[model samples]
Target: MDRKEQKSIIEGLLFVSGDEGIYPEQIAKVLEIEGNEVINILEEMQKECEGAHRGLQIVQYAKVYRFATKKEHASYYQKLIDIPTAASLSQAALETLAIVAYRQPITRTEMEEIRGVKTDKALQTLVSHLLIKEMGRAEGPGRPILYGTTKEFLDTFGLKTLDDLPALSEENEQMNEADLFFGSLQEISK
Candidate 1:
């Protein structure tokens, strides 16, 4: 409705978007406003976040907007990180990890196609757990990030190396990749 309302809505969108973040064009499309106006509002909001010394701040990276904790709170956050916690992986995260493990350099879009749903939260969890990482960027448009399993994956799975992974039967290999991914997830969850 008004500039304040627009800025507040944009903040909420960025907060909910998490690490994936949102683009100005996406905000403009949703708000039915000009892209230039969205850009100007976002810039002003960014300044307000910085000047206010609020615990939360807006970050723009790769043209994506996200809400993040201020850098000044890093020490406190690090203290919390140092605490021990046993976090269990969600089924979706396990499935995404399995796909990344077998596919070895898959993109998020490809993973989503296999999962038949958006995999952003699962992907972020895998990344946070250090089971999957950005191996590189793809060759095509936007150069989407390519994900791959890491050494932590090997250690967590108690495998000596990727070669230690069980081989799929010829018939199974021919089955849908999503099935293979789910099969792997079941095996690991055991």
Candidate 2:
């Protein structure tokens, strides 16, 4: 494809790669371009992201490229996170949090599998809100991050412990898992 198209594809690939990042060689393979070309394009994209108007920047860590927030705007980001709101939890965030609560130390992939959709954004939201945290890395290839509910999560839900969460019955298994999880939280919200 053309240079512009290549850059756009690279951006999407990097975004989809999430926190794992992507290697230049992988980008090259996917775009059917040379590694040197990928590096050049990445460098250009990195520069563009560094512009004052851009809130994101491309970061290279150990040869893996990924998008990250501009450190210069840390205060603004902190402010955004620190602001308290009466907004209820999003459906996706609630579902993801429920999965994490019921299934502590679960991998993102497993959560996505259970939800039948990607959970990256939901996971990020939960993490930013301090409702969930990265417990550790799971054992196996790639060593994906394992997530679990935080103390704040218990406090927010007014639960003394995870055991205090409503039990999921086998009959409920026939219903959508998200609905089951959401229903329990709705009661607490009232």
Candidate 3:
């Protein structure tokens, strides 16, 4: 395929890969092209995306490329997130989000322990919504996936930083941590 055609194919692959991203070698292998050629096309594609003033742009991280909204259009995207007519969080998803937001870098097992229910569905919902994502793997035998809120979470909730999260009440000795978690969720859900 010609360079232009190759660029188009690579762009489509990146879009399909989404947040997971795609490596140049992966593209080259799939397309039956030289790795260096794929890299060159990606470089050219990146320049065109920025120069064309497109709403979306290609970005590379850790030698992997993904398509993402341009930073300049954050406010426009934030407007859409603020008015999420398409998707609303179920009660379970909200509770899962609350736990992850407050006690981030936490494992699924830890959340399940606190909630006293399996969080598989709720965690999947949060991840699919881009509200929460894998922060990293936890230490120990199982090496469970740790979860944390995303930048989209901050933008959607109007938080300047994690510190902007509503403070948990320390004065009420009777108030449990779950109460605090739900309290934060209510604020963000608004």
Total clashing pairs for each candidate = 0, 0, 0
Candidate 1, residue 159: Cα displacement in angstroms equals 1.1
lDDT of 2 by residue, 34-148 (tens): 9999999999999888789998899999999999998889999999899998766788888888889888889999999888999999998999999999999999999999999
- What is candidate 3's lDDT per residue for 9-42, written digit by digit as tens? 8888998999999999999998998899888888
Q: Which runs in model 1 stand beyond 4 Å of their true positions?
A: 1-85, 174-190
- Model 2 — which ten-residue stretch has the worst lDDT? 173-182
**Candidate 1, position 148, lDDT:** 95
Q: What's the lDDT of the predicted structure labeled candidate 2?
A: 0.90
Better candidate by lDDT, 1 or 2: 2
RMSD to native, candidate 2: 13.0
What's the true lDDT of residue 58 in model 3?
86
State the lDDT of candidate 1 residue by residue for 116-167, as single tens digits.
8999999999999998999999999999999999999888877788877766
Query: Residue 71's C-alpha lDDT in candidate 2?
Result: 89
Decide which is better by TM-score, 1 or 2.
2
- Give the better candidate number (2 or 3) by lDDT: 2
Q: Score each candidate by Cα lDDT.
A: 0.86, 0.90, 0.86
